[model samples]
Target: MAQLDISSSAISIPTLLIVNRYFDEVTSNIRERPMPWEGYQRASLITEQELLLLRNYSSRTGLKDQPTAEKYIDLFLILINKLSRMDALQYILVAFDDTIQKFPDTLVYLCQLEVKSEGSPFNTLKRCLGKDDDYLNLKAAKIITDLLNHASPKFVQTFDFTDLLLWLNRQLQSENPNVVDVSVQILQGLLKLRSFRPVFYGKAHLMNIFMGLIQASREGNPQMLYQLLFCLWLLSFEPIISDSLDKQYGVISQLVAIAKGASKEKLTRIVMATLKNLLVTAPGDNLAAMVAVKLLNFCDNLATRKWTDEDILDDIEFIRQELTERFQKLSTWDEYVSEVESGHLSWTPSHQSDAFWKMHASQLAADRGRLLNCLAHALNVPNQDPTVLAVAAHDIGQFVKYYPLGKKMVQDSGAKQKIMELLTHPNADVKYRALVALQVLMSHAWDQ
Candidate 1:
């Protein structure tokens, strides 16, 4: 610990005047040098002892009012740049804590200078971040983040870093679009640096904070949302960090919902790409089924348009092909039952599982009367598709086959009349389902 030597009253008055005159000469000489960036490379060649002297002088009582503060700050930044260039960052690391504490405002201004540098600030930061000292790097990261949070739009816009994730987080909370945009850009840059990966992962709540940004995009900030989603997508490519199921499911669910409702074709395509990325990375039976169900709903909506029958049929064929492929991947009913019985089914389909389609199939086969009531409600909606109606009817017929009680419920509830009317539907699938349901009812009556 170097002590301040301000109490040396025994020193001659002439010596003090000479020191003051030297200070004036030094300040005057500093004016001859070019701007900070121009002189940074050369001035940073100064020796450690000289650098310490400058540091000490910059901290003297009258130094703040003297022109020396700005010059010293500039010279220190040159040293930073040199450290970055010569890879002598450990030396800077030893002094960074005290340097920042004594001149917090200087660190902020140096960050601005780095941002304005012509060469890559990202690469420079990367060199500094690669030092073996974690505490120093973390301190530097904190300072950079603080500076970026309060930096003007111009400074923030040109900023880049490989260890500024903390600052990126602060920028994420900014209300300014330009700041947010630049911050995201900076994050993207940092993410590309392999050295920063551990730092990024160590920052807890990072994934959740990003997801919150994704959710915010739904209300009209798709640009920021898209940037965040893309970053998450890129991150998911890394096996070690991307293995968390909660992070995967949360991001995917939001993306899938957005894809389903997005009117813009490009955004829809991007969302679809994100979904595909997720599936490729962490495919599960339930997730596959949920995707299939969403695709089916999309197809059903598309079918209602008054297009040529041939075009509609072609679209339906494509959708059916996709659904069939996905459905084949779903666990069979017997498999599900076995899993449930064996306690292997940790997730319930009704709540977290996307097996609602299969559940619908099962309920219809075991309880026609309940199926009929559900159909009644579905049919009441205007512009309801006949295919959905037919599927419901087929499910009901299956229920009647497995459960005699379903027929009793239908007959007792007068749902049989509705089933008979559906038999006259123009769509063959609906008529077939309706006829099959009615025949099952008649058979039950005859058996009795």
Candidate 2:
């Protein structure tokens, strides 16, 4: 690995300047290159030639008192940023990884140099539908990717990656799928910052990023696709952005495809939760389509599984209830009954209150236990009748909704699962009543 003393100031400018003049003709013409939409390309990355230049620059930077130490560090990084080959970049990173830490100012200039390179009309990353081979853009993107991978959050932010964010937006529009995928990856990293996220969200250009992520989700590799979904999750945190993104892309179908193809390997829960957020913000018609595709079953199946993670279970439960409620609206009473028999009915409407069960306030606090015991006894009588179970489910649903006390009682007792299990009863009415009970429980849980 190559090492440079960033604090040193003793260097032969005349000797290095002579070497640079010799290599300028043989290697990259890295002077003050302009950025695209911002100028022209000036650097070339011939690896062998760059190695020689990097070595010469590294050696001369050793003089501790040399005031020009910062300048040497700055120039070497500029040349590194312009490197077009991954192998060349990997070499630079390995060689100077430790040395770069001593100079934040050099990191800042490296970023500036990347921007300038992209602005060159010959820039590789700036393309749309019709395109030349995206050499410069692709190379620049790879450098950015590597830099982000190895950089500290402080380093990246200190250099103000917001301009890099803007540059990435342009790359995402490129016709070359490779460029778009890499661009999404960079944006995904940038969104980790609360500060940087709003910069993207503050403007209309966010829509472009939204669409780009969705497109990449479909076409990108597994890692890229996962990052894309995670990025979508972050974007979904804003109600307005998620709503607008849904209006533009209606990504439910894409999300569904991803879920279906997930192979139960990784990201299934995150993908499902993101789908829930999208469902919450989605238009009515879009939500109805979600129901038509049986989204509730998707989550219910996952939520009921013993191995699901706690957060994932909670996420699935939330989506299950939300999707079920919408499904209930779309389903007929008979259809809901069918769902019960098939163990597919997941939602119920609000429970109806029975006048006889409504307690007086003063006695309510004192006799709550007595009232719950009486209800539990009535519901727990097995094989008595399906009608009894149905009534029990309905009554409990109403009691839980109107009185907060009922939730603790039901949770402490076996009533919660028993009520849920009734959805599988042979009699459709019994199953329907169980659905009513579960809906109330779900609503209460949601409130908690």
Measured against the true structure, the TM-scores of the candidates, in listed sequence, are 0.39, 0.42
- 107-163: candidate 2 lDDT, tens digit per residue: 344445555663321122222112233433333443444444334444444444444
Least lDDT summed over 10 consecutive residues: which range in candidate 1?
Answer: 9-18
- lDDT (Cα) of model 2: 0.52
Cα displacement (Å) at residue 80, model 2: 9.3
Q: What do the candidate models score in CA lDDT, each in turn?
A: 0.49, 0.52
Flag regions of model 2 displaced more than 4 Å. 1-72, 76-166, 173-178, 194-220, 276-293, 305-311, 321-448
Query: Which one wins on lDDT?
Result: 2
Error of 2 at 335 (Å): 14
For all candidates, the clash counts are 4, 13
